[model samples]
Target: MRYACPTPGCPTTAPTRTTRCEQCTRRNSRAHKITLVCGPPCSGKNTWVAKHAQPGDLIVDLDALYTAVNANPTRTDHDQPAALTPFAFDARDAITNRLLHGDHNLRAAWIIHSAPEAATRAEWKQRGANIVMITADQDTLTHRAQVQRPNQWGEHIQDWHRRYTLGHVDRTVTTG
Candidate 1:
């Protein structure tokens, strides 16, 4: 069976066994459904991903991908933010290819904090995904993140609070 290439610029026929043609296979192999969970750091995105994603579900975590790209399984140094950007793009590309190919019945999530995230959310929705935005109040988020990691909440807590105050989050679902 043959399938159409999901990427806009690519003109190729994808096989049913694989969502991508030979030219795109390497990138398409990772394609799947994306459920973006955007919030401040420690906003339970990982917890939600763990809870909702099934066994075959793909998880495109920026942090994890960054660590993998850096070849550091244990990225203990929090100050090296610059080292993570390239890996983040690689992971994003992989995830985008997967979404285009529809290679797996994927349920994935992203923890974002910018306008670009909104665009990403729109793109996923256009792809016929069920976008569920999860949100919580500043105090609650701080409390949870503090419970999860005491020292890490300094910057992320303020960012989340600011985003919440500015109403940056859209189509959000408040959950306990």
Candidate 2:
């Protein structure tokens, strides 16, 4: 049974569970098509996934993870403490790494983030991710969030823009 290497640039297949040809395995295995979605608060990253994602497709969304471990599935309260964030990140990474290396059942995974760091985006791109960055002007984003959370949306949007690194996004969609 020959399995094709899922790595981005590798073109070999092998009869092994490592999902890599011998030569490719000498360095590392193939990477999976992990799509990372980024945007400011209320930029509709979740809406995009809800609109397009197929059932059974894995999604790594921080709010969803927070919901999983807490009672309120609608919001992540600010008072929930900083420790939970890192814990959820760990779980997300473990799932992503395992699927990237071993699982053939899933064609791809979606990761939702406000990831403004170039290094983080580059790391995901190198790991075979297609970045979908949804963008909107500060006023637009603030208006979108004002209906729900008015006090903090502007700051979050500013932080995201401040940390955003140009030239990292594979696909950019401007909402406003």
Candidate 3:
């Protein structure tokens, strides 16, 4: 019941059912390989995920879902913070629930601002998820965001940038 680490380099041994060594596994099993692509709003998380992930990758897009719910296809009100939290929580729940189903063919990318909550990460890990983290700088994010939604205002972009930069989201990839 032992194996090698899949994270490239680091000659670490892991349990057969786990991707990390015994100690690493104990520490990380509670953490899922949930690739968090965090950056300011408009950071191209969607574009990056679309380009990088394969066909079966489940994309949990809170913005998209919100737009659909509000019937606002253009996302004209994304800057309104008060309007986004419920949508975010719903998206998180949806992603977590899907991951818990234990379907190996389900690869996924979530468009979230920061790393998932510990409980959510653990749920994904127990369901055998591999996490990866992707990020970009403020300038890159601002440009992408602007390009993606030309009609949106600068204040929106600045707000997202500030939040992301302040949060300091670190990325990691874990595979089971």
Candidate 4:
């Protein structure tokens, strides 16, 4: 059973954290139906998913999963999994794969993203996934970031704006 790296932009796969390649995590496979929720941080991706996702609808938000399993849910740490540190992304990716394949009587899935490259979005679109993007001006992003995260939300917003250039998408929401 080969697993995939859930971390964005890192496609290298490994067996497990113990024996898997030092690149990405690995786990069971299912087909992949992913709805890419594209937006900047603090742009209401989590809020939108919370409002939209019904029960039994698979949600693949990495930070939320990490928070669910960790004492400090808000801790934004990735890649370096220490002995007993938080490393729930493996589980997230595995479950996401299952959801995409519609395993165990699954239905739709929501995947929150931070401005995926156009090619990446196109790949998912080809796999029969939907894309939802929440966008706003830089000022709005900065204000929302201050209200939501305050520490680095502004930087993340800038990053998203700089990275987002995809032309074709299923839906676009202009958030203010």
Using lDDT as the measure, which candidate wins?
Answer: 2
Better model by TM-score: candidate 1 vs candidate 4: 4
Q: Pick the candidate with the highest TM-score.
A: 2
Worst 10 residues of 4 by lDDT: 23-32
Arrange candidates by lDDT, descending: 2, 4, 1, 3
Each candidate: RMSD: 6.7, 5.8, 9.2, 9.9
Candidate 2 local lDDT, residue 44: 81
Name model 4 segments beyond 4 Å from true. Answer: 1-34, 73-86
- Which ranges in model 3 have alpha carbons more than 4 Å from their true place? 1-33, 73-88, 97-105, 108-111, 114-140, 143-147, 150-153, 164-176
lDDT of 1 by residue, 1-176 (tens): 67776655668887664364675654344323455566666555666677777776666666665556675656553323576787677776876565565555544534332222556566655554445556667677777766655466667667645554332333566656
Question: Residue 25, candidate 3: how far off, in angstroms?
Answer: 9.2
lDDT of each: 0.57, 0.72, 0.51, 0.64
Candidate 1 vs candidate 3: which has greater TM-score?
1
Instruction: Return the clash pairs for model 4, or none.
Output: 3-26, 3-27, 15-20, 16-20, 33-100
Q: What C-alpha root-mean-square deviation, in Å, does candidate 4 show against the real structure?
A: 9.9
Q: Candidate 4 versus the native: TM-score? A: 0.68
- TM-score per prediction, in order, is 0.59, 0.73, 0.50, 0.68
**CA lDDT of 100 in candidate 2?**
57
Positional deviation of 17 in candidate 4, in angstroms? 40
Could you give candidate 4's per-residue lDDT for residues 1-176 as a string of tens digits? 65554444456664653343442222122223357887777677777888888888777876666556766545654312243233566776677566544445555578886654787677666556788877677787788767656476566667767776756688888877
The TM-score that candidate 2 achieves is 0.73
Ten residues in sequence with the least summed lDDT for candidate 2: 72-81
Which TM-score value belongs to model 3? 0.50
User: What is candidate 2's lDDT per residue for 22-50, written digit by digit as tens?
Assistant: 65553333345578898777788888877
